[model samples]
Target: ISFNAIDSALSSLKNCQSYINSGMDVATQVALDLVESFNDEEDVNNMEKVMLEYATMDRELNHYIKAFEETINQVKREKPENLPDLENLAQEKFLEMESKNSDLDFQRNEKYMYFKDQLKEMKKQYHGNDTIEEIDEDIAVTRSQMNFICPITQMTMKRPVRNKVCGHTYEEDAILEMIQTQKQKKKNVRCPKMGCSHVDVKGSDLVPDEALKRVIDSQKKQ
Candidate 1:
């Protein structure tokens, strides 16, 4: 399939996932309220299992879709058999299919195991106190951990530029100036992000993180 077709399908899958997750969230709130009003342990346990199954099913379907998309993109980029004489590359095609399947299996197994670990952690919760407030707290903490702010300026990045070498990001002007100052002095500036293994920043190593910039813009509007 064409890249546009693959992207459209992925978009649809993402929308479906969001729809399911919204419904699951509503159902969870209702379930929790019901359990609280009735104070029934059995119903709470059953409802939790149903919620887990529903979320897991949605996640699993999306994972397979993502794997398929990745495989197609890989095939286009790598072109396993681009020989002009070999018009019939059936064996090469089969090999690509096999590789895709292998990747799908590996990813599914790894994520499922991680999911089970999450379930175990949930089971360890003293009670179902992981409510909306708790969820909001978790979300906030997660966002704080994300690299939305530039390390150089200690501010929210307006134009985030990511280092290709170290996978860390900084504000575009700030990082460029840092690089320029070092180059003029005949020295290299290490990555600003603490504990980075990457030796130094190069002008070529920085690229605009357009995807992250969009996210930041959306959040600002919100």
Candidate 2:
């Protein structure tokens, strides 16, 4: 028979044989060595057989390192609104890997570490910053999902008022005071939220006095 026929027979035998049998141990061992040893087209036939069996014997043996990362991405895409839940998942997986990974030099071990560190940092940035949290909370409330982070500053905001449109809301009180000043000038002003420059006529009419009006308006806006 030709080398091709012999190669085909070996491939078939590798798949047909039971890996656990005692007599087949030597064959399995040789197949594994061949998988790692050969580096030519002629070796491809044997290599495929060896790899298929290895994968069949242990499905996760080659894919263990990527499991957590895949899981993280899956959760993030499927349920972005449940950021807290995602955060918990990240923490749980990170802790589990850290506790289990005594051998940091392993390729899978390093990947796990890297994934865990990234999750921790993202969680911290999401939770620690107040502005970001407020915006996230609002977005979560309205959209029932959270993806709003300042592109430039990475801050969470709620009804993020830009300075260019209606000036800025340096403080709730400051905004209130601005409304009072606008009223004094006979130019009714509205909340700067939503980038609108329009003064609030209903708001101006609601207050007993301009000073009290500003306070009530500020409270309503918040």
Candidate 3:
């Protein structure tokens, strides 16, 4: 495929993602409406079921997008010239990529999960049967999902940055300040997360953790 074709394919994947996100937003709104508009158990259950069916579609579509992203990236990096080679390469890489991933990743996707949790609350309100036990379970699970506290600042991270080297995140300013301090001392800092083996921290190793930030923001709103 031509380079323009590759770029267009990637752009199409992005549009797919955007449409999925829009669907999620609409689902959340529908859940809200159902909560207020229905008191019948069967009706509410059916609406929730329909909502979940769309959610499943979203999950499957996202998986396809990820698989295609992996295939296209491999094709671009290798720069295969001919049609047969590109077709074979894409198929082989797609199977390899699909083998390494599953629907679970999309289920745990931050934006989707965030919308799901909101829908759950609306469901609870619609049913008017949220037991203390279930709420307790939700609290416990939410606590265990992620640690938003920055290792360097020991506070809830507002702008988290993750290290590409170790998959650990810290508050952006705090990590940058630490980096600046270490540079002034003509030395390097290790990844601050305990038990991490990354020996040196560099600015290039840190990237913005936008997904984590969105999760954190959603938690704060709750």
Candidate 4:
């Protein structure tokens, strides 16, 4: 599904590029015609105006081409097989952190509470009156936080896949493997997400989440 969407977007970008090239060609021809139309100094001024317009359009075209290339490269990089086993890596990290000291868990929880309080205070400071701009800003921040990491992997997702049943997202291969392993164990493949109420999740519940994948890619670039 995501591959098809990427292909469609690429095709559209190519068509737009071709159209821009054609427009530049037409502009160039018009500039040449203006050059031959008159010998007066006024003709020189007109030619200069045409040239400036052409330059502006050319810059815009180049910008779009560069953007398209970046998008294609991002999509290619987000292929599922290329992503690391973030779930296993995160588990290893957790085990190492725990083995070093049992107090680490308490410290982590305390830090989470401290940060949550700080965030609340900041939000109150910035959004005292709950104005439209403040509300929009808050929404944007919440959305960004949601897309920044995968719940199961506890890492920034490369190729995100959505669980349609519960509207949760995870790294594609991680979720698939989880589902397969759960199925082999002969247990209900419920969502592994904490606090999620979803049950009886199956492999078919997962879908390639292209929008989330793009968001992840964009966040990584930033």
Off by over 4 Å in 3: 50-55, 79-84, 96-103, 130-222
Could you give candidate 2's per-residue lDDT for residues 57-113 as a string of tens digits?
Answer: 332322333344555566656765534453456456655655564332332332222
What local lDDT score does residue 1 receive in model 2, on the 0 to 100 scale? 12
> What are the TM-scores, per candidate, against the unseen true structure?
0.37, 0.17, 0.48, 0.35
Q: lDDT by residue for model 1 over 1-222, one digit each (tens)?
A: 346865777688778876766665655555544443545656755655666666566656655565665566566777766422221243354445545443234234322222232222232232344432333121111112236789899999999876756667899999999989999999999998878877778988676654456556657988
Off by over 4 Å in 1: 80-222
Candidate 3: clashing residue pairs, number:
0
Best by TM-score: 3
Candidate 2 deviant stretches above 4 angstroms: 1-170, 201-222
Against the reference, the lDDT scores of all candidates come to: 0.58, 0.37, 0.65, 0.52
TM-score of 1: 0.37
lDDT of 2 at 185: 91
Candidate 4, residues 94-206, lDDT tens digits: the string is: 44544454323322332222222223323333334342232223211222234547777888888877675676778888888887888889878667778888878777767
Higher-lDDT candidate of 3 and 4? 3
State the displacement of the C-alpha of residue 95, model 3, in Å, after optimal TM-score superposition: 3.9
